[model samples]
Every structure is written in structure tokens, then in C-alpha cells.
Target: MPNHPQPLRSDYKYLQPITTRWHDNDLYGHVNNVTYYSYFDSAVNTYLIEQGGLDIHDGNVVGFVVSSACDYFASIAFPDRIEIGLRVGKLGNSSVQYELAVFKDGVEEACAAGRFVHVFVDRASNRPVSIPEPLRSALARLQA
Candidate 1:
């Protein structure tokens, strides 16, 4: 593995707790690799909805994830309580690059770290649009 920077809990601005379900584990007795992405997605959307006032159902603008990548450092299994740390690494006219890390609750070192990029777009037209003010303001607080 390349020497990617391993993220610590303190590196993130927002932390969201998530409970691991039994189904999250695969035949290997650990959380499947794909499940980590779901956690990342949930954490980001939760922040956008609760803090950024993103209206996923009826809003004129919606964010569509354009890119994502993850690096795993350790294993996690079902019944483990986890927290996902989130921060904005880059903010653009119509897109935001969110940096996130998954940690076993209360642990400092991240088990997995990832980046997710969302491009805000018109729901009907499906064309990119400038991020709305409310969402931008919310994202500002998460800058790292």
C-alpha cells in the first residue's frame, strides 16, 4: 500500500454515530468493504440534511455524488458501534469534496478513510448548478 496519510479522529469537524447491523458482515466475519461506502454516504447526507438544509425530496437542487474512494486500515465487524468523521477538503462552484473517516467509537485512529465528491445539480434539468447559499454556509463550518 502507498503511504497515504492515516487520518485521526481529531482531523474531522463532524462526527456521526452509526450502529453496525448483522448484515454488514460478510463471510469473512468482518464488515464487507462495500459497507464502508454506505457509511460514508449516510454520514455526508445526514450532515447535509440536518445542517445544510438540503431538501432531498422536493428541493430544486440535489447533490449527486460524482466520485468516491476509500482506503482501509483495519477490520470492523457487526455489533460494533462506529462513528464516521466528516470534513470538507475542497469546495467548488458546483461541487464539494468531502473527506471522511470511519472509526470504532471512541478510538482515535481511523479504520478507513475516504473522499466523496458531490456535484450539486438541478433536479429537473440534471445540469450542474452553483451550490445554494444555505448548503454552502453549512459546508463552510466543516472545512479542514
Candidate 2:
């Protein structure tokens, strides 16, 4: 196995608690690897909609996922309360890269670490556009 760098809770600027659902576990009794991506998505979009003034329904500017990657360090199972740590690894005019980690409740070390990159685009034209000021400013606070 390739050696993956472990991330710590202190690396993130925001924390979102998540409850593991019974369905999240697979036949192996651990959260399915695919579910980690959902956790990453939920954490990032929740912050954007709640704190960054993102208008998902009627906004002219929208963000599309351009890239994503994850590395798992440990397995997590149902009934485990998990906390997702989020921070901005890179912020650009039209693109932002969010770094995320999954930590089992009360753990200081991450169980998984990942990154999601979003490119701001015009909803009508589907072309890249500068990130709006409100969103940009909100993202700035998350810079790591």
C-alpha cells in the first residue's frame, strides 16, 4: 500500500459533525469507501450554502466539481459519530480546492483525508467565471 499522509484536526478551519447511518456500512461492517465522498460533499456544500451565501436554486454563478481525491487511513462503522474537518487548500479567481478529513468522534487524527476542487461557472453559459465576492470572502476565512 502506498503511504498516505495523515491529517490532524488542527489542520482544518471548520468542523461539521455527522452521524453515521446504518445504511452507510457495507457487508464488511465498515462505511463503504464511496460514502466518504458523500461526507466530503455534504460538509463543503453545507458550509457554502449556510455561510458563503451560495444560492443553489437561482444563482447565475454555480460551481462544478472539477477534481476529487481521497485517501483512507482507517475504517469507520455505523453508529460512530464522525466529524468532518474542512479548509481551503487553494483559492483562485474561478476555482477553489477544499481539503477535507473525516475523524471519528473525539479523535484528534483523521480517518480519511481528501480534496475537492470546484470551478465557478455561469449557469447559463457553462463557462468559467470569477467566484462572487461574497463566496470568495467566505472562503478566505477557511484558508489553510
Give the number of the best model, judged by TM-score. 1
What Cα-based lDDT does every candidate model obtain? 0.94, 0.94
**Worst lDDT 10-window in candidate 2:** 1-10
- Against the true structure, what is each candidate's TM-score? 0.98, 0.97
What does candidate 1's lDDT look like per residue over 25-140, in tens digits? Answer: 99999999999999999999999999999999999999998999999898999899999999999999999999999999889999999998999999999999999999999999
Cα lDDT of candidate 2 equals 0.94
lDDT for 7 (candidate 1): 94
